[model samples]
Target: MAFKLIFAALAAVSLAASSGAYQLPRSDQLQPLNPPIDNLIPLSAYIDGLLTNAERMKRGMGPARPSKFSDGSVTRREPSSTPTSPSNPEPTDVPTTTPGSGVIRIHDPSSSSTTLYWVSKDLNNFGEYGRTDDISKALTVTLGSDSGRFSIRTPSPACGCVSDLPFLGGIMGYATSGGDLKSSSADYAYLGATVETANGSPAVSGDNSFTRATGISKSIESSIWSISSDNSLTATWINADGAMVDAHILYYAADNVLSLTADPVSFVNNFGASPAVVSSWLSDSTLAVKATAAI
Candidate 1:
């Protein structure tokens, strides 16, 4: 037991002496860890070396060796010229994508059929409409001896253009001959309240002034024409099958074109059957009106 206790005591004392808790060493025991410094590169030269190699490294090239003759000035390399080929010609101005402006619609009262005419404008969508220096000249349409194209039911079937509408012929006639329809007080001269079968069928207004066109026949049954307070003219008619056809024609001097809009208003108002909703040609490209809830 005594031998074991003595061995433990000696072991504790030996650990304490080797644990770095002893007194410090004298200054004579230390030595220099590095060689004497000399011949160091100047701060400017070191910085220039770094800068020179930085540009080369960025360009994926090896750094140049330091030279005594180098002025340490950075020289930028010019960009390489791009090769030109026939397949890669320079770009040019892009063409315009706008559509033509003027359009006209024609309707047939007998058939309740309608046709669209892009009058004055390019029907082929090429670019623009035909420019008319004088709209008065463009509207000067002379009456013809041929039966009217707009006739409903008679010895001859319907035939005529929008200008052939009742009362329009005299208006166009006077306009072409340098007569202003707006200032004309010839109240009941050209037309009367009722159709004068003796004379060519002329469109009569509520005030009884009617004008005759050459081709229009007097066989119209349920046709009515009215002039609005603003001088805008509208003609309504019922087809053979009771379809309501309305033609609204207005003159726009600024655009030098006549805007004629004709459509079938109430198919069931006269015919008594719920007609199918008119689907637009744009339906194919349109999105659904009712949106679905997103997940």
Candidate 2:
């Protein structure tokens, strides 16, 4: 600490009024420690040596620091004040573990969680519906037209897996284009984990707009975004039949595709049941409501 002060003083002097302009008077100050000295010159040199050593020791005690050099000039003056050992509030040992952290554990009040929602919007039209049931397998429904090539994506063993219930409520809406009836589209969502292979199928909701696509169907224009919590992200979904289809489905501007499956047979037959029916399709990738969920 003493060495730091001495260096600071030297540095101040070094930067003081460049050599050319002005001349200042020097003050004769008393020596610190009150020692009766003989040669002031030797004492000054000794003080300098001690400070240099102190500086070196300070640096050596820790990680490498920026290098400092001397200008080789010294001015005679009184010794500086007693070194002021800097005061720090002591380091705060933040916990290294989460939830299960040991030692002086601390909890952040700002922590939060959220539930992802698969919402279905209502678009006053006939809910699209088209599906292929394999006697002992699963049900497969084609998205509106060729919105995307994905069959075997509905709730039923024949379709390969079952559908899912949204984190919140299900959907119920009209379809601009009738599903399966046109063979051009079998509007129905696929429930899965990632989109490829599904844990199970569930009522789908990507498109939400009531308009159709240009040169395509207007029902596919309903597009809405899915949001979630911050701390953790969930990329999995459970099918409606209470099984894990383990498939994934994503929507965006580049890929305008969506599915809606409301068993036309049970549009009214199984209207009110567990994990209600979700019948709706998209002109592109947007999904409309009319889908259902009762759990």
Candidate 3:
């Protein structure tokens, strides 16, 4: 009975093999053990291409499209043709005076001295003063106490103070532009020196001498200046609770004299006279400072 049972099992295996019911899978029929992952590219490559296309479009050129080669290489489409017109020329009416080593001269209205006073940088790093009549010598004076020299720069939109120097790294402008001149710097310090009410008169003070810990009050609006086509600098100061006044770059007689000690120049709204008197002087070009290109 045991021999007959073994024989019956062998017969069943042989019958299945002969009928091709039991067969090993061929190479083509085999399935992958793991699913294939899609190819990945760096994000920076896409960003760079986007920037490049944007610049090309700005220049009046056709936008570039990326193409993939049979060998799995990518390349940008070449421009159909070169741009016919030249890149936009810089505006001719923009102020010719650039931010660099330059001379700032203030008109002296006195009959005794008709020469212009050069705005010399102070050693205190507080404020600038008018001391020298010679333009050549004034340019040699260091801008601030630091080794890096300072230059007058205009922030974007051109509504800020031209006196904004590189030493402080600030954007001096009106409150509407962004923030007040007092809050231009990140540290909440004044650029150069600022004029504020002191004992009922305008006084010049350093960054540390601010009346408030957060620098000048925003309502004062003292440092915002405008440059004209002739390169003349002018500014208007408006007090939220007081009268609006025009800014005049004035200096003390003692500070203007060449001496061993000098004081920073005063930026005042008046010289013990009516505001109209100051306005006339500015209109006649007899009481203003012109920023010119450095020699």
Highest lDDT scorer? 3
* TM-scores, each model vs. reference: 0.17, 0.15, 0.30
Models sorted by lDDT, best on top: 3, 1, 2
* Candidate 1 runs further than 4 Å off: 1-224, 248-295
What does the lDDT read for residue 184 in candidate 2? 27
Per-residue lDDT tens digits for candidate 1, residues 1-295, read 9999999989887777799554344434322211122422222221223335664343232465444537776564332367335585322221111121111122223345343221121100111112222211111111212232221111100111111122221222121222222212211111111211212232322211111112111222213343333322344433334444443333222222232223212211221222222211111011122122322
**What is the C-alpha local distance difference test score of each model?**
0.25, 0.24, 0.31
Query: 1-295, model 2: which lDDT tens digit per residue?
Result: 9999999988777766565434443222211211122312221222322334453233221222233448755543334567444385222221112221111111112234232122121111222221211111111222212222222222221111112211111122232222221112223332221122222334343321111111112212111112223211112223334443221222211112222333322321222211222222221111112122322
Clashing pairs in 3: none
Q: By the TM-score metric, which is better: model 1 or model 3?
A: 3
- lDDT score, candidate 2, position 51: 30
Error of 2 at 169 (Å): 8.2
Instruction: Choose the strongest candidate by TM-score.
Output: 3
- Ten residues in a row with the worst lDDT in model 3? 272-281
